[model samples]
Target: MRWRARVKQLLLVGIGTAIGFNGVAVAVAPGRMQTAYGIDDPTPDLTVLLRHRAVMLALIGAVVVVSAWRPPLRPTARVVAAVSMTSFVLFAFGTGVNAAQQRVAIADMVLLVALATATALPDEPRPAARP
Candidate 1:
């Protein structure tokens, strides 16, 4: 059980770090992100929207990281992570998966699985045995 909890903590932190890094990249270079995501041409409006999305992603990642230390917030963080990853996966498929999109979708799928596993495990530590 201790190991399981540690694994969950690691996964959550890893996911959070990955997501936060992506968000930072996107925020810093929306045009580059657009190209990387397979968008050939992006308008100013699209760039603005992408920046907003980047902010949201960063916020979510931050929450997930913070929740690692707060048991009560873990459930909410899990739900947010699951929803965000699942939605990205669906959107990637819906839009048609290019090589880059496929890679991102795969990562999102892995994160989804990790979040699910963490959520399924017990958050509280095991009770101590009476001597």
Candidate 2:
């Protein structure tokens, strides 16, 4: 049981790191859009939107990472991560993604599985209630 909980925490942290890094990359280099999503010659308006999105992802990733060590935050963090990944996967498929986007969708699918696994394992036991 202890081992299982440790594994779950590790998985959550790893997943969070991946997500956070991706956001950081985009935030630092908006040009990553060209390689990551195959967007060519994005307008200034699009760049603004992309940067905003990067910030959102960063926030979500931070929550997931922090939740690993803060049991109280796990549920909300899990829900947020799920919604973010699921929406991207559904949207990419529903609208027909290019190769680059398809790769991202695939990665999200894998992350979803990892998320499910982490969710399945029990976290730390709560303290006993006061009399």
Candidate 3:
């Protein structure tokens, strides 16, 4: 309804859809890390990296959820969202998913963009004034 409400929604969805879902997918989905980039890892580095990414994203998700619930930290939330977005963008670039098979990467990119969009909402204001 309101712009502030919309911004909150954006943050939650971006975090849940992006970090929460993606983190779980990366952590437990069989061969997700390896298959995400279509690579053949001889030492399971991707798996370890994927797990690490999952933990980082889980923490990020907690931050997002907390910010969404409280609304007083919207600016910091926005900053976190932006950083999260950047991380996935970097992943997209680093993984080098082909143009044709970049759907997952693109989905992540969408989440980041959504976060950026919420951050840009004029109604959101500074974090202290939000709640």
For lDDT, the strongest prediction is: 2
Task: Report the lDDT of model 3 for residue 29.
Answer: 71
lDDT (CA) per prediction: 0.81, 0.89, 0.65
The per-prediction tally of clashing pairs is: 0, 0, 0
All models, RMSD in angstroms: 2.9, 1.9, 4.6
Q: Candidate 2 has what TM-score?
A: 0.93
In the range 25-125, model 2's lDDT, one tens digit per residue, is 88889999988787888899999998888889888899999999998899999999999999999999999978998998999899999999999998867
Please, what are the lDDT tens digits per residue for candidate 3 over residues 1-131? 37677666766755655566657766677366555545455257756866787777766776777776566766676677667667666877887766533765676677776776665555544457554
Candidate 1: list runs displaced more than 4 Å.
34-36, 126-131
Give lDDT tens digits, candidate 1, residues 9-83. 887888888777778778887866755577667788888888888888888898898887777888788888888
Candidate 2 least-lDDT 10 residues: 18-27
Best-fitting candidate, measured by TM-score?
2
Error of 1 at 93 (Å): 0.9
